[model samples]
Target: MRNFEKNIKNKAYAFQLDPMPDSFDKVMDALEKKKKRRFIFWLWILIPGFLIAGGGLLINQMYSSANAQVQAQSLKASHLLTVLFKENKQGLVHEDKYALTETTHTTTPENKMNNRPTSETQSLASKNNQPVFIKESSNQSAEFNNRNEKSFVQIEEKTNMTQVPSREKWTPIIFSNPYFVTFPTHSSNPVYSRTQIPFTKSTLPVIKSNSHQTGRWSIGIYSDLGVSKNIFINNKDSAGFGYTNARQLTDKFLFSYSAGIQFRYSPVKWLAIETGIGFTHYESNQLLSNAGFSWTTSGNNNDPDTALTLSSVDPQSAFGPYEYQNVYDYISIPIKVYYQKKWNWTGIEAGGGIIFDLPVNTHSYVADENSNMSYLRHEVKTSRLNVFGIQASANIHLVFHIKKFGLFAGPTFKYRMNSMFDKNYITRQHNYFIGGEMGLRYHF
Candidate 1:
């Protein structure tokens, strides 16, 4: 019995080292196989990641181009409006009926021998009803000396000034109106210099305020890339199976991605409500080690009774380390409230929300010795995962406006509110997602 027990102990020891090959060439071969498997695993992740990133970039470029065009058109319309207003003021002033008049005074000397005002001066004085006066000066010539002769004479003179009407006729230039200015007509068309259209208050163009337009609706498309980790709680049962003198199985963060469409409505200048539906995919890589017990029986049917032996062996050590990959897919619906502050061309938005995560699929893969991978059957069903699967999220966005479109980028954080898996499972896990989100939105 002692020898049989020793043999069983030796066999258990040999099983521990069975997966590690003795030959250097065999080790290299195993390493090469691991490399191939790793390459394929990363390929699966990288291909779709690159595709989603590329698609997002393409859409952003298209939106930017369209936004730039719309901005240019808006600027053009503003400049045209300014020009139209200026031309309208000038035309009104030129057509004004008011005129300015000037008066002139002239004096002519009267002959002393025949001191009488001229008929032309008398006729002008009679029409104007003015009197003529004469003055004597010491420097007057004495040659015609009658001491009574006056040296200076003042005569009332009337000057007829004809008022000339402005020759530039105010022929209404219909082409210069705001309608034509805001929406320019083709230069090749016949230009109408005049129109019978009368100017009225209703026909005048209404100027829109420069304030930000609130109470508007907008639609957006967003994509995010990040890393996620599975946080296992209530893991005491599973922890017992860990390798000797080692901590329990732990998960590592892996790349994750999400894409979705959002709709937003603003009922006030600074507040908005938003909702969106999206697909979120999370992946985690884990190193799992466990201790397992097996029973061995010796002595064949010839013996009345067989000797039974029980042994404990590190399952990970016997079969090589286990590489576990957990993938979760969810269709998420989010409802959020936001507060936004806008500047002339930029805006800031802060929001928090609740998300309902409906499980679409769940998969777990385990890679063993020889780099062979197989799917593990899980008791937690995808349909049951939604029972407590909800998330709380918050984000702050920086938005730049170009015409009717906005470009936004921000950091987003999410915390799972409940266990992602059923609580009855041996290991219950939750997840946290943190990442940068970027997108483009069109405002109406």
Candidate 2:
């Protein structure tokens, strides 16, 4: 029984049972009853408190910095304006001597009006005892009066000179921004008042004349996705394999692309001379002809009825599946004198030009299948250079203008005067072609 008690004591010690705090059981009971209440308490109290504090601190910092910057900028601008004002004041005082002289003259006029002694002077002149002294003083006063009159005339002349409009001031401001105008000073103002009558009192002239058309320059880059037909230009009587190949190589529905720059001169509102230099690339491929040899082997001796005969003959290559491609890249200089009839935001122009088409790179690639057993089964390719030619264009241009800039797009029917190929093989000349051009223009 003592051992059993000791064992129970050991178990109790292992567990170490202690009494709970006063609120621990109650808090545990509350937590177990509503798990969401604890989360709501923490989220509503701690989270919102932290966010509000952080946001307030950030806003305070930004407002402080912005206010400091604004204050500094305002101080700097005020200082600059003050300096400009002082400089202008000093310049006006130095340039107009009347500013100082007028102040003195105004004070003198006030003094003269207040100190009039005409009756006393007349009584002194009438007294016989002081007649000589009065006469001498009167003569002195008369001389002084004559001198004052001359001085008054001189001051009036100076005022008139100072009143003339200052070209230096107006010229600089006009050149800076001629579009805007500032109101002139009133005649009652103390500073620069007399000079305001000319520019302000006179009504500003109406700008009734139409805007003059200025010179224009434009450049355009375009990728054309169009079909073209490449027809053969050869001598009718050429008796060669090359002529036959050329005729067979011509194809329809080829690819073409062009790039150009156009310059325009506008002599009138609705008329201009448009000209440009441009480059064009035309490409096409076709199956022309194939040349090969054909031969048959002799019959074997196993059959007694077969007769042995030896036959020999010559053979020539014929037209078959030979691939060919022609690429014509030309530089064209076009001069077009056009008339533009302007509508609200668009214009139409129809013009023709004699374009000097300089053949830059004209190459025709020809390839034939190799059927020989000794060599690899590959196609044999050959390239040839071509001669240059001239082309003419008659186009109706449609212009879409936004302000003074415009986009010109038009369909042009082009005709070449000569074939863009070498004359040594096939000498026939192609006389015409058709294409279009789109460009951009800017007017000054």
Candidate 3:
């Protein structure tokens, strides 16, 4: 080895290394491999997100289409009524084996004074035709008599009647429902006597419509029922009872509940955003098996008259579980974005968002030192839970729309991405929840 080192040192000034272009290609190849891995990771995340969005949009479209169809049906009914009325005015000839006749005429003082034509009278009747209304002025009288389900109408007018003479050029009038209309607001007032009245055309329009439409806002409230899982991750760098293999993993989760009110607005058809206030309750029965307990006298050292009590806890291992329970309650505010789709009367919705949890209360547990080996009860202690934290969640739901009312139900998953405890605490805790939620909604 000494000979080789000496030979290399003696010839070092005379030797020169060559630079190969292949080395640059190797570095570039490594960079391309890293870029491909990054793209794959992003693709995994994007695939499910797009799927959820597509499903939600399809559901929303269905709901919108269903609502529109219902509206169209109602409009069709009204249009049918209008068409029937129009056909009657146009004197359509019916081929049915039924005869119908209607006669309406009015004579005003002005028309008589000006010698203008009074009115046009038309009638049709066949075998077994039903009797219909006949309206006339006070100067004239109408009598309709029915015998054996047969109808007869007679009108007596002082002036000579001018009837439609040609059936080919005649405009026949039919009345399914007949009644007198009150004088319009712009027309003259009623006589309030048994005198002949003239029909007046109103100058003011009725039932005018504009281009305005309803707003794109809605509100809903919901309550969710599901089980929540608890995860306690140990901080390996921390000293003493750091939650590393400290808990008996027998129990995984406990019952959890949440309820909230949401106010949403949609700027377009397929998308919406909502924000709301929520209340959540999380609990766990998972017991700590390696926790430590200690007792120490606490008092002012300078005062001889004061009494001291056992008041300290040691961060060590070896305490056993006895009647232990962990509970946390939080008030949350959530901001979420949704993708929606609809088909027929049903729709789908997918959403993701962040939750800001403000801790309202909790109960921490300590094992009882004097309990029997079989018992898992604990000594109740003050809580050491976090005051405020954050979480993320994704959810998918099926929605059913019934006019202005709706229903939603689906599964959701939540993860507390950050540790609840700060660096001051020995253990780090994260929570995972997988649950189903169902609720009702109202729309305007």
Candidate 4:
């Protein structure tokens, strides 16, 4: 605080100065000289070292080659000497074994006792010339060999030959292959007996069958349910029922269903002729707002009427906020032709044909809106439903086959081709239905 600023300027200062530029040049020169000296030293040392290594390897290869040649020659000479020595020894033994001997019988007691030498002086290899080997007869060898080893080398050969089967007689087990070739054998052994079975192509049944495959009969049962619509099918184009055009009545068409049994015949692989009898139930629903639009043709559930004619009477009445049902039941007979195709497990068939239906009856019922439209019924009878009619239909089905039974399902369409009443009858209906059908069938 007293004189700090003045003392700072008076303090001794040190600064490092850069080396002179020439100093860099001197350092680089020294490095180059040092590197050159190392290069020269290694060049002189490596050349002579490589020469020495190369010469030593060459000398070693020459010496090893010469040594190996000498070892091979020595081994061959030793093997030859061994073979010659064995041959000479065997020749000497052979000569000694059959040395010439005079025929003398040692019968006298004095001669026998003198001839029977003992210990080292015995007749082992004396120059007296005696036979040490004997030519063997079959009986002697067999009899003597059995004394200790029980026919060691003699009978053992015959026994082994009898035990082992010969290669020519060996019958390999040809595992049970039905298609294998059978060879004939004359051997009495049961194992060698092979009975040849002659199989001809004519013995096999053909894959293309001629029976139920085509020209056959089949039977089935089917059922289907879907929407139904009734329309006027006349040349007059006449419209009636004044309250509503039947189909325009709110909620006009709901559902129709049928169940039936069918008998079908196939005349060829791809074509079928079928006929069936079935029961059909058709229904239509209509909404009533202004106290039910009525059907004058019906007798209001056959209720008591004051007037003469049922329609002139109280005339069926229904209230608002209710659903009315018009129902028709029919006994249907169908004549159809189908194009059928089949495979191992599944098939498809599609065809179109005509059907005839005889109406069983017609009835009308009602359901209250408060009841969630459940069928609360009130029916009226009418003779107008007995008319016979005809229809055209087409169907396609996918069939799943299991053995003799087949299950089939697909879409079906049918349209009434004719009016369901006499020509003069009013309110003629030609009903048509669209729905899926399923059936079960059996093959013979």
Report every candidate's CA lDDT. Answer: 0.47, 0.38, 0.46, 0.45
In candidate 3, how many Å is residue 36 off?
Answer: 51
Please say which candidate is ahead in lDDT: 1 or 3.
Answer: 1
What residue pairs clash in candidate 2, if any at all?
Answer: 233-428, 234-428, 290-320
Sorting all predicted structures by TM-score, with the top scorer first, yields 1, 3, 4, 2
Give one digit per residue, the lDDT tens place, for model 2 in 1-444: 699999999898789656644357557765874575455445435543554455445433333223223323322222111101011212232221211111111122212322332222211110111111111111112111223222110011111111111111110010010111111111121111111222222222111111132234444443222345655543442433343334444455554656677666767655667667788777665443333421111122222222211110111212323334567778867777776776433568887777776767765532211121111112212222334566666777776544345556667666666655444333443534555555556666
Per-residue C-alpha lDDT of model 3 across residues 322-364, encoded as one tens digit per residue: 2244777889887888888764346788997988888777764
Query: Which has the better TM-score: candidate 2, or candidate 3?
Result: 3
User: Comparing 2 and 4 by TM-score, which wins?
Assistant: 4
Per-model TM-score versus the true fold: 0.47, 0.40, 0.45, 0.43
Clashes of each: 0, 3, 22, 0
Which model is ahead, 3 or 4, in terms of TM-score?
3
Q: How close is candidate 3 to the true structure, as a TM-score?
A: 0.45
Q: What is the lDDT for 284 in model 4?
A: 68
Candidate 1 residues 118-144, lDDT tens each?
A: 322121111021211222222111111
> After best superposition, candidate 1 residue 72: deviation in angstroms?
14
Q: Any idea what lDDT model 4 has?
A: 0.45
lDDT of 2 at 178: 12
